[model samples]
Target: MDDLLAQFVIEAAELTQQAAEDLLALDCEPGNRARLDSAFRAIHTLKGSVGLFDLAPMQGALHSAEDLLDLAIKDNVELDPTRIDPILAVLEWIDRCVQHLQRVGTLPPTAEDEGAKLVLWLASGRAVTPAPSPVAGGTLPQWAAKLFDANPAIHRNGAVALRYTPAPECFFSGDDPISLMAGVPELVFARISTRENWRDPAEFDPFRSNLIFEAISMAKRADIEAIFRLIPDQIAIAHDATTDPSELPAESHETTTRTIRVDLARIDDIVGLVGELLTAKNGMSALVTQAQLLDGGLALSRNVAALQQDIGRLVAQLQRAATDVRMVPLGDTLRRLSRLVREISGQTGKPLQLVVTGGEIEADKTIVDGLYEPLLHIIRNAVDHGIEPEEQRQIAGKPAKGTISVSARQVGHRIELAVGDDGRGIELGHIRSTALARGLISAEAAAALGESDCLELLFAPGFSTSETVSDLSGRGVGMDAVRSSVRRLGGKVTISSAVGTGTTIVLSLPTSFAMSRVILVTVAGEQYGVPMESIAETVRIPASAITQVRSNEAFALRDRTIPILRLGDIVGSGAPGRSEEMLLVLEIGASALGLVVDGIGERFETLLRPPAGLLRAVRGILGTTVLGDGRIIMVLDLEALLA
Candidate 1:
């Protein structure tokens, strides 16, 4: 029963989100009947599902919403723009109820009243009026009145009256209808009767279920619904609201497939096991290397090396398969943003269009989940501060409607997600002035800063260019939070803007948080790991091949000069070697830099563990990993090192 309830919560949450997406889409493409049908179906299914839990309030609200949608479907009434808010309000209420149930194991005390108000408002297509009071000594059934009179507390709080009629062939469906009603929480009254007149003893079919079960329960409507969720079509629920809500009509299905729902903890366990397997594989590789070094001419050593290679291949395949299970397409997150854009656009009275591309790119589930808030902040900022008002946009020779383009794509081993707008770009001068005024940067420093450096000030804590605080922006926190979040994910955030064109913020993040492919390099006497994705090329250059430009050393590659920094000096490992040094070219945004190392080692994939203790605050080190030879290798953060 707990598992069933959990599943219901998950399904209901998804349905609500889908309904919101479909409704928003239907509003945009009013002629798209498919979207309209989808919206209706989502609400209809939600209504049916809520009925099983005996959540009177939720069922009533959804039932009214489903009816309205049904009417719209039948009468071909274009969804009135006014109706959208109420429809969304209904979904929001359901979401809240589900959350409440999840937290406290039952709906809130006001759920029934709140649901009734929303339903009344929806049904009237306007504000809800006060419902008339129920008559004293009302036409209550004898059983109901007796039960209530006996338990005054139940009567005062109200009770859910239930009538359950198991299907004639319900036995074949493995339903024990009597046990279902018997299990109703806080059951106050129960009565059983035959659905039809009794037949001859011999004529009675043992398999046919003719019992009609009725009961009254002090338990909340949601509890009653949950008790009968599996057989919703076989039950009826009534609460003591001013008016009785009707039951959801049942639909029959000829086939059903069972699904094994595994808890997220189980999935995390699998990922952990896979990580251990990767570490073990690394140890095996190191053993093979050691064996070859000790017996280079032995056939057994050669055969063992070949076997290690095959094992490495299989390990890589298994790691990928495990990682893939934890990945989900970005489409779900993008759709949520789409709905957000619509709501914000409506509220701000700015005609805006959200153009999403490459949403099909897959990302780690954990990463994607954490992205919502950061993306929300960016989108809100774009709508509120980036996009100009329609009149202003038209005067600027731009279209009346502004466009916010959100795109995601997998680039090498990193995922690049960019949010850009076709509106007024950020002003560098204003940002510099704001930074200086906020004491984030010195006046002289602000004055001498280039455009890119000035733009970076936007991410400084408590720095904003807005003259006044409004519903959005001016809080001096959004961009800073975005930067912090991306940094925590081992990602970087970059911004590009033109004075009047628009601003684009791009986030580059590793494709997998659990494991990564890295190139091992020996610096001085210590070995370090550099993310393979950051390395553009590796070349061995003679000491004299490097040219000194002023106080900095640089090297020319393909007619372009890149500044070079020695890894040993940067990491404080040791002095640089006089021999020909291996240099790794790293691409950082639009620029490239060269890092001088002692020598390059083989590239391999390894699980990345978070830094511990004092190393957590260390900027240039990403994480630590144990190599096969029991050596701990520090993964270098190329971005931070370059910074």
Candidate 2:
């Protein structure tokens, strides 16, 4: 296989897998002509690409499937559930063939040689199409051979698909999936989706290629053909069902519907451009308003309001587009964890199964993807350390096979994912001893720590109860990594375990990646955000109310002494700034902290990306949120700043 063709083959495998998964989803409601068309195009593209490289096996199978699908669509062929298994079997065939080719120079011997068998099986999958009678003389006519040439030069499918199936054992080797994308021959567009389910990255074996791709193109089938041709069995193809004009209403109907199917990435690009435009318009309009006041008095101000109204409309549209791009089912993440639990049960010799609930909940896709790794680590750690072995469970009078239940629910604007397992829970004593020995906590503190306080130490670095290390799950042995990942992703993870019962790991993640209603406060001359969530209320307390208790400054309210952390004192003001009347009363956990600040400011929303380089070194700043007015406000790292 030539380099380009080989690459295409590799890409096609992934895209095809993705295409299959997506199509299967639209199996019901065959009325979704748009979806059906998209699925068909993916398969058709694959078949066309196979022909380019003279890949007989893959091309043959895909061509057969595409023809059946095409026929079905023209006459409303059912996306019968029974067809899914066989189709997946075909995809598996493609995967196996691709793996073999990647390892060796040649295609391995298989059913590909049995063309009669493939035709027989494919024919059975569809409505009975009359087979032409066999010719008496079994010789191809010269003219017929020329007519039936593999490279017919007709690109039937206008769109493409990219598929990925993380190997069942992919979790054993860590492979950070960027997505199911491939540089294929005649590419129109590509999407990345998973097959089966996701395994924990720690368990995903990188050595194995579990991801598959399906690309669509009518220009050339060369790229995918070379890579996928060798391993024909592991890949499958069909024509794009979406582009079939025979199905959709004419172009005239486009304007009547308020919504149109759009690629998410395109929407993301539009959101960014619109955001920049919104910012530029804001600055320009402000300048114009100022100029009008100086030059023409009230003339430009009249038009300025109109411009601002236009900007608001644009901003609203931008948000709708972005949200559409970011929205994804919570099930995507939960399904992955469910798969991980099954793998863990097998790996740890613990008889456990995951019972998943409420997966249909929706959340931002960015948060969902970032969450996969952290959730995986916590669950695996629970199995490895939180759960007892089958023998131990039996001795405890519990069922030999344990159960881990994962659930997701949308409460207000945030989504919560809980992983609960019925197994041996943590021993706080072990944690206390471990924390003290490791010097993470002093012996005095360990002795005074309550069970809940000591148990939290497990989230600290190097705090694991596993006596012996196994190779199945990695660095997650120290759950501090999980904590860090969660914090970085704008989420939090907490564990509650009852001795001799079970453990539940709950992760709270935001539904919005970036918001527009952030209230800003200044701490020690520097600005910060209290996440509106952790804010109870900001009150200006009398300076005389502040009193010292046990050498720590405090304020008493409602018979409660809340710890006072002068924002200027803890965050230093170049020099001890003047004491202020207002205190930012923030509640975290079970305690309250009063942070004195130089001033309180207006509230606005902005996109907050992680600080880079020097800014990251600054303490107590989770991230910086940009305001529509162009000011950047640092977000107070609540845990570090207050805890």
Per lDDT, the best of the predicted structures is 1
lDDT string for model 1 (1-643, tens) is 3544665777787788789888888778777788888989999998877876879888988888888888888998777656666677788667756755754567766777778778777866674544311111023445445545665655534566777889999999999887787688998777788989888998988899999887777776766777776775676665544333221101000001123345757777777677677777677765666676774546666777787778778877877887778777777578688778888888889988999998778887777777888898888888777899999998999999989999998998789999999879998888987887888889889888887767877776786677767676545566878887786676778999987889999998876686678889988778899888778989988888888999899988889988999898889876845758689999865568999888888787777776889999898888887777667899998777766
Q: What lDDT is reached at residue 5 by model 2? A: 50
lDDT of 2 by residue, 1-643 (tens): 4444555556666557666765667665545666666667887777666665655776676776677667768988666555554454455455444544543434445435433344555667542223211111112223223322332453443332323334545444453333223435555544444554667898875455555443445432233434444343344333333334332222112211222445766766766666565556656556666867776657667777677778768786776667757777777677667567777777888888778887777777777788888778877877777678888888999988888878888877788888888888877888888888878899898998887667678777776666667655555446778777777667777778898898888888787665544567776557777566667778887777888788777888778888877766666663353454677778754357777776788765555555667889986677665555677667777666654
Task: List the candidates' TM-scores in order.
Answer: 0.56, 0.58
What's the TM for model 1?
0.56
- What's the distance in Å from true for residue 245, model 2? 16
Where model 2 places Cα greater than 4 Å from the true spot, the runs are: 1-116, 119-268, 277-310, 442-452, 467-477, 528-530, 547-552, 569-574, 577-581, 589-591, 612-621, 640-643
Q: Model 1, 52: alpha-carbon shift in Å?
A: 19
Error of 1 at 533 (Å): 1.4
Query: What does candidate 2 score on TM?
Result: 0.58
